[model samples]
Target: MKNKTLLTVLSIIGMGLLLGWFILQMKPPHVNEKSTPSANQQAQTKTNSPEEKYIALTPEAQQKAGIRVKVAGPVQIKTVLELPGEIQFNENRVAHVVPRVEGVITAAYKHLGAPVEKGELIAVLESRELADLKSQYYTAIKRRELAQITFDREARLWREKVSAEQDYLAAKTALAEANIVVTAAAQRLLALGLTQDALDTIPQESQSKLSRYPIRAPFDGRVVRKHVVRGEAVKADAELFMIADLSTVWGTITVYTEDLNQVHLGQKVTVRSEELGLEATGTISYLGYLIDAQTRSTQAHVDIPNPEERWRPGLFVTVEVAEKKIPVPVAVAAEAIQTYRNQPVVFVQHGNGFEVRPITLGRRSGNGQWIEMVNGLSAGERYAADNSFVLKSELGEAMAPQ
Candidate 1:
């Protein structure tokens, strides 16, 4: 029985040894420690690497993208007030010509778009009423001449005792009445815009010039509108022409309620027209006291000297008023600012890479073409002046899913 037990125990030991060998064979294969990295080493590699916010571009790519870089620096920041306006006729230089008497138009020497000088004849009128006045003037002159001769003769006769005193006195009285009549007729012609020279030059019994009345220009200007034609009858209150001197024009700016306080007389204003490629400088001449109820704006006038008359009435234009001048430590082109991660960022240049720099912005200039950098930027740092969006786009691509 002792020998059987010993054989059984030896069998058990053999089975245990075989099981141990199988377990050893089933274990994972060995690997080189130097070839594979630890978790801490992988994390250190990630921490040492540069962030994805930067984008590198070749010199050729930058040139092709039209990215212009400029150094941030101090600049003069002007607070300008820009407003929409229109070119208009200067009211002070505009005239509405009118005739003073009812007459038939005999001649028209001026037409629309005609340039005229002061006192230049614009038209001629013929009137029977003028003719009657001239005839009366002539009769008064003749009567006065006859009365003077009679008075002279009667006075001589009375002094020589050849005629009675009563006859001489009566002749003197008739002369006085005749003189009064002549004076009355001369005053009447003067009231009709006829000069003293014209009255004194009237010919005796002149039928040819009696009914002629000339309408002349009041100032040197261009005839913009004409309402009279030859042979057409015009009344005393008729507006015959509209003449305007284009040497100076008005730039009418519509000032909103918010801008009303900023505008004032004597402020320098610049007027520009994109369509005509014209620019002019002038001073604010007027400001309306009342605001328009519908537009909630007021009218401001700038007297622009249009010596060439390039600014025509009704032409739309933009007006820039110089409000105040400000000094800024750091200024940049407005286009340099871009949005990244929902914040304003400007691309700053490194060696061959551009870094996305977040910035705090101050008030933009009234022109909106320049901006002030309050923080996150230093003077002398090279930054993208224009076309920075290309860099921003490249950065987005770099951060995208790989």
Candidate 2:
């Protein structure tokens, strides 16, 4: 009986120890079903928030994205409103030549575009009328001399009481009439556009001198066009050589009527010519008060000196009339302005990736280094300013499917 009780007690202790271990394991709580999500849900999430859409770039990709080519475009360090215009001749330096006499063509000295001095003759007309004038002058002189002789004889007779008062009076009247006739003849010759030399050298049939008319240049200029040829009969006040002096040329530019205030008298200007090369200059000389009612443009004139006569008239030129320097925003090269579905866009850097934003642009620099941003941009935004084009392409492709 004693051996049986010992075996029973040992068995009870083993069962108690097994029960305690089983309670401890149950308290620690081993779950039979899965309480955590699988790996797939962690790897791929579906959400519409920007936070979800943004994917952090790898180290290699971030470095590559930062490495961008430097490109330059117009920047509004100072905003300028450039007005356009063309070249014109100074109005003060233009002149025209015309004939003043009504006669038949005797001879012409200068050709259609020949140069001449101020007192030079243009065309000569042989007037049967002019020859008659000279004859009248000589006849009048002879008559005056005879009249004076008669008056002297009559006066002597009157003093001696041998002549009537009417005879002496008639002799004096004749002398006065002859003097008036001679004066009228000289004025007639002078009206024929001739100098004293020309009048004295007038070709006479008796003298056998050929008739000639010399035309002179009114102002120094190239013959733009001619209207008449030699021996062609032209009427009085006929249009002749159209001459202009080109020492100082006019830059005729058109601007909006509203922009008149931006320009001022004698403002300094920089002139440029593709054909003539660079760094030329001029100044604003005149501004037209009247706006072109039809075109809504005001005409402004700039005078550029043509010392070597290089600036030719009618050459189409581009002008830039600069206004006051005002501060404004501008950005990257032209290439950076990419078109997404016909919308103007630029790539803006955000975190590790980039996003597309629309921008409004203004005038480009002459060298195309910068462009003005009229709108669609704010200050203090870091853009992919230089090589934004490459990323613009990437963003466009990335969003196309979405």
Candidate 3:
């Protein structure tokens, strides 16, 4: 009876062990599932390389950051070249005033910075040479008058057969010689810049005023420089004053060798000065044919009208010249482009997220508000037009060395 009881207990334990093993086999195996990645990690993974540059941003986040998206479309872009420039006096309107005669400066009617009109007297001088010429003129006039009286009396006598013909002929020859001397003296005074009116008036005026020389302005302009002072002696060729017409000026740009082909006469240019808060538009008036050996550049002159004389000479400025206009199939706002690793890029909207896209750019508009896409973009593609810098910053923060 004890053996049979033990056997039964063993059989029951064996059945229980089998049942537990089968139940365990029937249950599912445990696995470690991965957690969801954060938005930054996902963006980094998308933009790991240039070929795969992309950013994943939620719609709500994009809206909160003021990111605006627009479709790339056709645009007309002008090829523009910007270069440093300077404002200068128009050489055509500049005058280097000279005395034209040796004299002692008696009075300076116009000083530096004084505006003068055409033909206005600017200075007065006393000349000894002029005094000598006036004396000669007066002596010649008196001699010619006496010769004329003699010739008239001799001619009357000969006509009436009262005087020898040889005597009358001699008197006529003397009168002709006297007239020649008078004409020669007058021409000498004319060469001294004495007008016919001045010559006629000098004979009627006092001898003391005959030596006075007046220097007149050549054009309507302001005296920029005065080289003579009162009581100073000056030579005939001495520069007395420098005058310039400020109504028009020049904006000169240095064009390099590579740019010589693009810049030409009559091309439109826009000039701006940041320091003076000034802007003006002009046309290219002149182009240098020879290049500067030292600078490897040539000059391009633009004529800028300054009716109010606001643009002063020697002011530094910038010039923008539009070389050509081209029609582009795809273009975007200039603000949409961003630099990544020295390459330009734009953000394209992909579903609810944004993808960073690399782009090749062509010519930019004259005003620099728009840019033409040479490649890596297509028309009708939606991109972040404004505030795209936000995505760039976020991506940069995520990719920074941690």
Q: TM-scores of the models, in the given order?
A: 0.73, 0.53, 0.74
Q: All candidates' lDDT scores? A: 0.89, 0.63, 0.90
Candidate 3 whole-model C-alpha lDDT, 0 to 1: 0.90
lDDT of 2 by residue, 1-402 (tens): 999999999999999999999988786567754566457654554432222233334436746666343323334543344666566777888776665544456555566545545555555555455556656655666777888899899989988999999998998888888788766765776675545565554433253233333456665665544666656777657775666677778877777877777777798666666665633478888877887779998877888898777777775555655654544455566555767667776655567665566678776654455666667656555555545555655554555655
lDDT per residue for candidate 3 within 1-402, as digits (tens), equals 999999999999999999999998895865544366778877777657654556778888988999999999999888778888999999999999887789999999988899999999999999988888878988899899999999999999999999999999999999999999999999989888788888777668787898899889989999999999999999989999999999999999999999888888998889999999999999999999888899999998999999999999999999988778889899999999999888899988888777778899987898888899989889999999889999889778766789
Looking at candidate 2, the ten consecutive residues that score lowest on lDDT are: 47-56
lDDT of 3 at 184: 93
* Higher-ranked by TM-score: 1 or 3: 3
Sort by lDDT, top down from the best: 3, 1, 2
Best by TM-score: 3
The alpha-carbon lDDT assigned to residue 284 of candidate 3 equals 95
Tens digits of lDDT, candidate 1, 1-402 = 999999999999999999999998896878988688899988877644433266777778889999999999887788888899999999999999887788999999998999999999999999888888877887898899999999999999999999999999999999999999989998888777777778776764368889998888989999999998999999988999999999999999999999987888998888999999999899999999998899999999999998888999999999998778798999889999998888898988989878888899986786677899999899999998779989888877776788
Query: Between the candidate structures 1 and 2, which one is better when assessed by lDDT?
Result: 1
* Residue-level lDDT for 158 in candidate 1: 100
What ranges in model 2 sit over 4 Å off? Answer: 1-81, 103-185, 200-211, 270-280, 327-402
The candidate that wins on lDDT is 3
